[model samples]
Target: MDPTNGDEKKKRFQEAFERGRDGHVGSYNVWLENHGFDPSRVDRDKVTEFFRENPTKSVNQDDVTDIAEYAGFVTTRQDLHHIPVIGPSGIGKTQLLHTVIGLLSEVDDDIDTKLLEANRLGKKTEDGFLLDEYSRQIAELTTPIVCIDDCGLDKRIRTSLRELRDAVDAGLFVTTWTPERWGVNQDQVRDVFSPAKEVHLRSFTQSETKGTLRVIYDYISQDNFALPSKTEERIHELSDGIPRLIHLLALESLREAYHKELVPGHISATDAAADRLNLSNASARVQDLSEARLTVLKQILQLPDERGVQPGTLVDELHRDKSTISYHLRELNEIGFVERDRKGRRAFYRVTETIEPLVQRRISQEAEYNA
Candidate 1:
């Protein structure tokens, strides 16, 4: 249909919606009802006011701007582009993407934004009509932005990075995934997207952690919660620059302060919360070894015979620089994932039993599935 006819239909729908006087009657309304939210109790005006008050919605504007620029550069679209932001969970990836889309939509009335979780797409096992229709709508719409949340969580659909590369080639398709699982097939990923730009996001710095904590406290308390310089330093040290950990520590400290009716100044708290947060975040970083380290692990696990090759012999077989191999070996040894045996003056390395299965599985997956 022509633009005029489409506009007329939208106008008619609005008129009918207003005249009903009963309430909004549509799929969105139905969704609210199913989720146990009473449509009548939801005041549209209040929702608008809430969103206006929390414009950034827990996301930093600088990160959003960076992603927008990167997306534009890759998509070659002057106005908009789909960029995939990869990071660990609880690092505010989704928040950043949503903030950017909201900002872009505000500037251009013609742009439409749609958010879909990868697991909910028609790519799942128990498929539904809702997902099918949603995908169809996405393909049909001329929207400038489409954000797919948790793209790597759907193990079935994210089998290869090509699935996402194809989407990028077709149009803007922004997605987010954890570093460990961004692309399904790791070896084939580089082959599919030659020189694809990788934007690595590190945990916050000490200053950034302190700043984030201050912001959270200010937002929640509506008052400046003053702390001694040493207290802030301790918090930063304990949180280790992870944003989620910083937020948790700040909130926990605040809660303790509130419970005790402690004054805003000189608040003393235990570091237990920070320790727990660090333990939780550490697992996300476990699989993030460097390529050189992974190559060494693969070689040790893939050797045909039980008699593992010596470090020098393995270096010669792989035709890698001696220093590079040594660097990887040292890293693996430090991590306690590999052990070295001394044969005279020569060092022979073998995989520790704990990580041996993991290395073997990774190698087999890369050879069988990635190939």
Candidate 2:
């Protein structure tokens, strides 16, 4: 995005916040009561976080450890009063807080716990529903264990919410949302969460991405469904260890490959899951390949499957330099236009099954255009 566009957007949010802060947005004055926001220090993203939708997926491996630790912290030290869990969006912060609520109940069966997303609490703000009712619910909690998901989204009422948590002596578990992978969760954490032992979550690691996919794979295995062999590596590469991207790409790829439609009422299954988005991009990109690389791909498409062609074979068949052949082969494999098979220290290449027809179509078009 253009820097000026972002600056303008930020300016709008700051102006809106000022209206709320100065009591000009009279009905919404509850947000500034004890929320501790300084007009001089307003964070555009944190203060106006309702712009994003939370991405929820299966529990990742790191999240399991986080859940255990957080549940442990709350159960053993009830004196801390409030523990804010903060991280960039799609890092599973909301999922972690929700799990912690469940774990807290298991840790002590008698413990009462409730999970309320921040949006639900302040959803009626535009309808003139004073959030004081939600505040009252929090204030009178018989079960002092509370989980507030994505607290950044409704920060307008943060001061009132904090007071409610304190009034009930609640063991508040919260996650404040921030963006992901844009300069590494770039946001002003302090602008939203005060540093009272706030837990900062990290992005997913490659291993964690693979582990999360494996959990999904276990379910597909019973139906004999399988994905491409290198999917795990490719997904990890594409996601760069961001949990939301990892799951989105993996599930979409798997569903497209399996030719499956979502069952009724399963809202999370994307309607476009069967779209060959990556493959379509690869086709367009393949058309733009250098003459040398296109020749290499043409040969790979001709190579027989299972026993594919080696780089040395391409070098001899196409009369290309060995290093040039190797470079193009690596590029094709990375682009998902071709697959590499490893056998006892030897590597062979062929057009990927799903991409073979697309590659052939591009090659045919090139031949016709040249003719």
Residues 1-371, candidate 1: write the lDDT tens digits.
Answer: 56579888998878987945544556535543443344443443433333334556443456666756654553454433435576655565666666767776675656656777776553434454345656556656553466777765554443333444343234456677555454443344445543334444455767676666555544433234445667677776655555544555664554334334453323364244334333323323335666667777766654433345587876887899888888888877776678888878877788764344344334434544665
**Candidate 2: C-alpha RMSD after superposition:** 22.6
Q: Rate the local accuracy (lDDT) of all candidates.
A: 0.55, 0.53
Model 2: residue 216 alpha-carbon error in angstroms: 1.2
Q: TM-score for every candidate vs. truth?
A: 0.53, 0.47
**Candidate 1 stretches greater than 4 Å from native:** 1-62, 70-82, 122-131, 159-170, 183-196, 258-267, 270-272, 275-371
Count of backbone collisions in candidate 2: 2
The number of the candidate with the highest lDDT is 1
lDDT of 2 by residue, 198-309 (tens): 5556656776777766654443334323334366666655544555555556545533322343331122222243134353344456567787777786675444333778
Which pairs of residues collide in model 1? none
Alpha carbon lDDT of residue 270, candidate 1? 28
Candidate 1 has an lDDT of 0.55
